[model samples]
Target: MISTRDLTGLPDVSSLRRLLQSLAMLDAILSPDWQYRYYSFNCHWAFGEEWGSMRNGSGDEFYALFNQHGCFLKGFAHEALMTPCRDNPPKLWPGLFSNVPPEFSECLNEPAFDIASTTFCIWRYHDGREWQLDDLKFPAGSDPDGSGDLLSILDGTPETYYVWAEEYYQEAWNDTSGLTRDAVAAVYRHQPLSNELVSAINSNLRLEDLADDLRDIGYPNQKKPA
Candidate 1:
């Protein structure tokens, strides 16, 4: 469902690289317990060990990866069900898109709704163009159901992968909690934060709060309660 044409007209690859770097750093600051995994040309970061498992017992696992070629992927999966659903499935947390620029929003593909599975997004940039696929599926195993591209890109052993449930945020707070604007600016470099990202981080890093923040930014919050 995704094609290289989608990667047209995006900012240079350097910008995307910086955005991902900043996001990884911020995620580290917000969730200190997470482990960082690195490969030769790519890296993976996650909040829990059973991130890609169909039998994850943790609350929910969040995972993200970035490739040297400017491909960014991130997603979350709910604790697996004893019996998989047969109909309308759970949507993924859109908080990953919180900091994404508005211009890039137009590049997102329509979501492919399905039953219980890992929900994710993939963005690729090359030759000053960009392409995005959102709400894609990630089933257990190395087969290329839909996430084949993602799997192929991260072809390396992880340096460190922890198996545990980690809190994303310490507690609710009014300010950045000592995170200076200068620090954020340094990671972002030329990339600017979307209003959605600012609100999502401000709401104490709760997934629900991030969902609300997405709604406030005018994007459809499929994870939000009706």
Candidate 2:
């Protein structure tokens, strides 16, 4: 099973936040149609917290909350045996959520993320040395909790996102969709937002069109000052 130790690919908290923002921004640019996009980041999610989320429209989803205290995240992969269901009776796997900071109590049961059905959980304090896990005893397998499937996007790489987006959004992508490898890489690098960069992903989209999305992500809408 993919253990927390195996998650070395996850970037540091600050970088991960930027990566999530970039992913959301890229998805917004690629899919002007909200109904077709699978990712979202809301930096204004609450008074002092930002929420990063992904919902596949199927039964898989992950939610991450960020604030000065740091980040706390929970994910649900319904197909995983560890996931809670009527049959599974909502019992999370051992140590899955045992050690999250009490200050983050609100995130433990947010209705939108469906905490009762969660399969994996992780957290990191703002000044901590590393991302903390609860030392889960995963079942014998390559991806018992489905972290391998869900956390790949958090691997801090543009190539992974590119390959996945090409297949996932291929049917919806058109000439005007304007996806290119370099464009994807640029966003992944958290490059400064620009009209040209926006157009590189979707000719039909412009910074003006992505105003709301950029706002929700708490990303700069205006170009960096020269």
Candidate 3:
């Protein structure tokens, strides 16, 4: 239930590049720690035309997207067994519901999907109330807006969500060691992680190490020259 409005204080995109650069430096410093290998420093995928992704030696993966519209982040516990579908989208909604909370089910209406069967669980937050989408805006051929989930209409920027995704992937890695394709797919289907779980995962990460590395890399205290 953590909404984008709650993360309004996070740094904006202008600072994101410097932050990512610092993360890369931290990744290099933490190379000996197997748990930290999945940490990524590159945000180029945030600006790519299509979904861009990165994988660690352990096979865990993170995906990101950014454009004129907004941004998005997706992480898989491990490489998915299924190939990216170019034609028929997989029907995965029915399978996903069994794992999610009942309130989330209340948010369900007419769900949408991509060719790869990635479901778009759209919801609206306005007037301090959440509303579910009864209809979807499926992407027409070559329509940029149609490409991803219906997030552009949401209230806040994607920066906070991006940070949450990074934390989520790190948690997934920490909670499980050898994730199968089925387990990874299950996470994709049940996209949102619990706030309690997020907090626990965040607590376990050695983010201070990254902060120290950022200082060493000339981004002391997350500040960099223009």
Q: By TM-score, who's the top model here?
A: 2
Better model by lDDT: candidate 2 vs candidate 3: 2
- The superposed Cα distance between candidate 3 and the true structure at residue 114, in angstroms, equals 12
Off by over 4 Å in 3: 1-18, 29-36, 43-56, 78-226
On lDDT, the stronger of 1 and 2 is: 2
Work out the TM-score per prediction.
0.33, 0.90, 0.29
**Candidate 3 lDDT score at position 46:** 25
> Per-residue lDDT for 1-226 in model 3, tens only?
1212232332343333333443343333324253554344443332332222344555334343333433233333222322233325534323323333343332233121122233322222222233233233333333222212222212233343334344544464343322233322222233223322223333334434444433333332312431
List model 2 lDDT by residue over 135-217, tens digit each.
77777777777777888888877888888888777754533365788988888877777899888877777788877887788
Q: Rank order by TM-score, top first?
A: 2, 1, 3
Local distance difference test values of all predictions, in order? 0.34, 0.79, 0.33
The parts of candidate 1 lying over 4 Å away from their true place are: 1-13, 35-116, 134-177, 190-226
Query: What ranking of all candidate models by lDDT puts the best one first?
Result: 2, 1, 3
How many pairs of residues in model 1 come into backbone collision? 3
| lDDT at 190, model 2 | 71
Comparing 1 with 2 on TM-score, the higher-scoring candidate is: 2
